[model samples]
Target: MCYYLKLKYFTLHGPLPGMPPQFLLGNLAQSGLLFDKASLPEAHIAFKQRYGDIYQFWISSTRLIVVNNLNDIQYIFTHRNIYDQGDIYVQKFSIVIPHGLISSKGAKYKRHAGLTLPLFRRGKIVSNFDLIVDCVDKLLIRWRAKSPQHLHLDIVQQSQNLLLAIFGLIGFDYDMETLDNDNDTNKNELTKALQYFLSNFNIMLFSPKILSTIYFKLSSQYRQSQKTIEQYFDRMIKQELDNGEELIAQRKRTSLIASLVGSLQQDEEMEINKSEEDRKGLSRNELLDEMRLFLLAGFETTSTALAWFIHLMSKHPQVQQNIKTELSNNNSQGLLSLDQLDSLVYLDCVIKEVFRFCPPINGTVRTLTVDDRLPETGAQLFRGDQILIPFHSLARDTRYWSIDPELFYPERFLGADKDHHPYALIPFGGGHRQCTGQDLARFELKVIAARLMQYVTFGDGGNQVNSGGHLSKLTIIPKHVGVTIDFDK
Candidate 1:
């Protein structure tokens, strides 16, 4: 009788409210997540509507608190000590890139972030404006060749290639050759490996953890892709290490590889006598993992954002025209200078609106470290409890917006919503654990959007083809992004 009472008291359901779990399946059967009745973002909105902001969602047997209100989001995001990286976020990435910053925690994360984050700061990224413009021009050149016919282009693949090219040159000093006229995606080992990993990674995300682990070890295809990726990274790392001393001597050290190699060498010398816990530099394996993570991070999010930007432009030609008007007024002929890029204030508003409307990331997760109650909702949270901060829900909340939250009005940012709550429109998230490469991501989006405005006008590909829906992957990308690309020049 005592044992039964204890079991009843410590039930996994706790006090939060959600749909009753169906044996081991939890709410998966009713969640509409399995059958594709609605996209993940749409499901989140539906959940918010059904169960108010601070409610519970069960994934398998695990219970997660879904917090959509801005006050609760502010509290959770601000309190990093109380709410660290959630297990879901850490577990999935740890399986793939164990030593990467995304999987790391506490001191190790600090060391990794410390060495790498500075490389992506505004000062360094702004200096690479011309390089970014050159990459955008490569995409323009390719599209120009295809402009003879009124092609209904799916810009996702092209955007990915363009981003890959930019990240290769700007981040690693290597040309991905993605934008090359003769380049083939199927034959490219690195490209193929990345694609294979992401596809499997998505599968693993939905599978039971033990099953995912077993699949990883047993699958020959996964092993081959892993080997190919490791070999590519190994060659790159070795080349960087070999050139490190020469580059340092020449006082011309640039690129992420050079900086990372330099830091590694410095750490090796400085921390040779230090204990493992006290050591500051990343190990060789850590470097390898970081390389993989950086490649994905550098290209994936920005490319996804670009895809959304194009989709939005196709739907709203007036907004595109406004951007073009701003560009022309600034006389941004040829490649724009840093001053010229900044001078297009209306263009900046459009980019901000794009981020607000369809944030590339649907949500960010945080796990509570101690027992607490939400100040606004008065919901009790346990130490091990996880919370989903839905970016889409927060942005679309009617209480926070002066204009209708459903409307995609860039002018809102210039008017009543200009002084909008900072936490409400956090596409990159907020607080200490916010995305480190946010500055670079924003700059890349702005520059690319500005360049596209100068060169092309995207027209609606019609409702049958152009109707926008979310496809949730590593990022939330457009499900159907067919746009008619008309070159302004």
Candidate 2:
């Protein structure tokens, strides 16, 4: 049966090179992925080295074509209609946020994107700059209270707190109070529920894809977390409805949740006989999922990126000093305007390098819609086949960089490696399905980092704790981020 299945699925792609799979388990057991023995990103790097660019990876009977060539990646991302959303992407995210934009495609995706994308545009995000700074100040205050004697801190948790507070306010006009309330018991019930959901979801990353549905069904904690999350969304929706029309209209400018609620109400008022294709707004369940997606994606990716930035800064004091120099050179006084934030050129390079060095997402997957051939690699692909485009691999590949890709230097962006291929350093995946909240994420990160630079300098706690390694969750975050925070007088 295994041989027959292999002949049927794998052979049709024309004997693509990859590690031989174990019977029944496929490559899961041999790849050390099933038991958490290897990091998936590193494993992809190893496979690319061994198989040369394009290779096949199997999770049980499921097959994935992992591609490392820039041209192939560019072609796949650019031609979104042909590749759509990958099976793996839709499969994994659908389990968590089935109705959200990340898991959707075609007409449903058009509806969700139409309703929500405008709220995350650059103009709307820039308008909320002060709100972001205010949230960061609350975090700074919390950290200041732990000064001198207790300055050593795990930035993973600290970054999480800061981002949770920021997203809670800007995303929904709700305050998580994660910074003010340190004790888990004292956290808002919604915050606690979100924490619980994410913790369990992280565990799901290690488990096999086939077991995800069964695991969610059997896990009582998972069910309870879902219930609590739903309850929170219910209240938010009711509050939005109670505000009537005027408040919702005003909130559409600043609050993503308010905008979504307005869209939902619009859907309700749509003509009943209209075709599904003509419908634009989301249903209530979808509204809940979109809210959950905003909460989950908003905080999770930005927090992880901030943790990476902090970890990188602690290791490279020179880079930190450079950023400080840039800030001082600009005579940045008090909170910076959006134009002022954009003026910090060196700081911009450092942030870009942080993303390249360690993308929050390891890779993005895209599934083929019709039979096609890769433009550069000449690899034949079948309809419904999924491909993995590893961001870490692309960033680290020496072939694509004029400078040593292994080095953690930010200056490469300004000098010899300047004008690198556009697709070479995509922390956020590209093309039509690119991350909607990316503008907001980048703006928030710049504001927070800039604020931190003004008031404090991060020092390496020591080799034992500060030496960089990553922990893979929904996003990749530092495994150990103990660092000393010295307050500037």
Candidate 3:
């Protein structure tokens, strides 16, 4: 039982309806109660049972206002002037993701988001559907021919392959594709450094970047990989820059880099005279930041999502059957189309439910911009305090969900009572900070689910996988568990 607020002699009226937090630690040690899977299904069940809907919980001395009510969320996320992406323990990301949209906070975030917003508009993403579909279709064909040996294809590996393909086809006009997840996914040396950067990122986070400075500076392996990846990125960027005028003139957009390069070039020579630097919006380093961001961000979350999808769907064959039934003949061709996603509403519902069940991201933190009090719970917080919105907990909150919110029933999503609060079902988050790649991520999940359901009947292999998956803050991932999969036809 977590304690509620303890008032000081100098403060306002009666005891505030909040939790009694640890003296200095706040609730960081005991705060796990907020995240407990057993405690999560019921929204504010743990908090309300002990601390009410809006209670103060501390994380390693950082204050977080844990909220379950709908309106409070709207007020906090909408009134960005008061609350923004919180002061984070970003030591983990500084050397890894560094300065991209995912780890970026404050007005700096808004600027980057505003500038890069053009690339992901509906017109562009929709236009590249064929490229995405082609890759999925090819993977499906490979899966269909598999021999009947309980095939627990490590989804971790498979997802990277798929993401790498996306990078090649749609993101960058590079033709490099890898069957294995461990090898080069790109034709350029840039591939090496990007992979090297992420694999070692956890170490830097758990330990410290200062420790790796020696290794990064002295070692041949780390240095070489960095050089290769950086060089390839430059080569690609330079090629695009050199061909900027002609590429746009020819109206060819083979990859994201090409598209970006074309977009940068002005219609006439007058544009160049203004400033060469203005014409090239993202410097070489800035381009790498975006590239690494998408590669890791896109690949990891979607892959883990697919892994979890397989984990749950395989356990529940009936659910998989229903998805296949919905997919029926609609997915016979190479890729599932946007129209197909609409028809397969149940499948879509299942994905939504899955996100609700096991959201791939834990709560993301934001720094307090101003002091404000919650109208519903009446908890007041000050400026500079950090707030973590636990999406994983929110999705499973029984207070907001239907009958035993922990139960994974896709049918629960079908009813007229499906008007959930924006913050209520936030696997992709809400408000301005919401995920930009949501459409592509959902489409990819559907295609992978449809592909696996079409050909493979999967079962859990009895080794060790994170029983519930590990939370990396960036995305939650299932550990290496041997799963047995049998072929359909």
Cα lDDT tens digits, model 1, 1-489, are: 745633432234667666665544556567776665566678778878887877777665556788887888888888899999888878777877888988888888888888888878777788778999998988888777775446556688888888988998877777777878645644477777776886676656665566678889899999999999889877877787676587744422346777776666455656657765688777778888888888877888899999999999989989999998888888885668899998989988998998999999878888888999898988988898888888888898999998998998999989999999998899888878888778888999999999989989998888888888888677888888888888876
Residue lDDT tens for model 3, 29-56: 3535334333222333455568656566
Q: What are the lDDT scores of the predictions, listed in order?
A: 0.80, 0.82, 0.61
Candidate whose TM-score is highest = 2
User: What's the lDDT for residue 5 in model 2?
Assistant: 65
As for TM-score, the candidate ahead, 1 or 3, is 1
Q: After superposition, which runs of candidate 1 have C-alpha atoms over 4 Å from their true positions? A: 1-12, 23-25, 182-187, 244-246, 249-253, 265-276
RMSD of each: 3.1, 2.4, 6.3
Candidate 3: regions farther than 4 A off: 1-63, 89-92, 97-99, 102-108, 137-146, 151-153, 180-192, 203-224, 249-254, 262-280, 329-338, 462-473
Candidate 2 local lDDT, 451-485, one digit each (tens): 88988888888878887676667887777777888
TM-score for model 2?
Answer: 0.94
Ordered by lDDT, highest first, the candidates read 2, 1, 3
lDDT of 3 at 408: 81
- Return the candidate ranking by TM-score, descending: 2, 1, 3
- The prediction achieving the highest lDDT against the true structure is 2
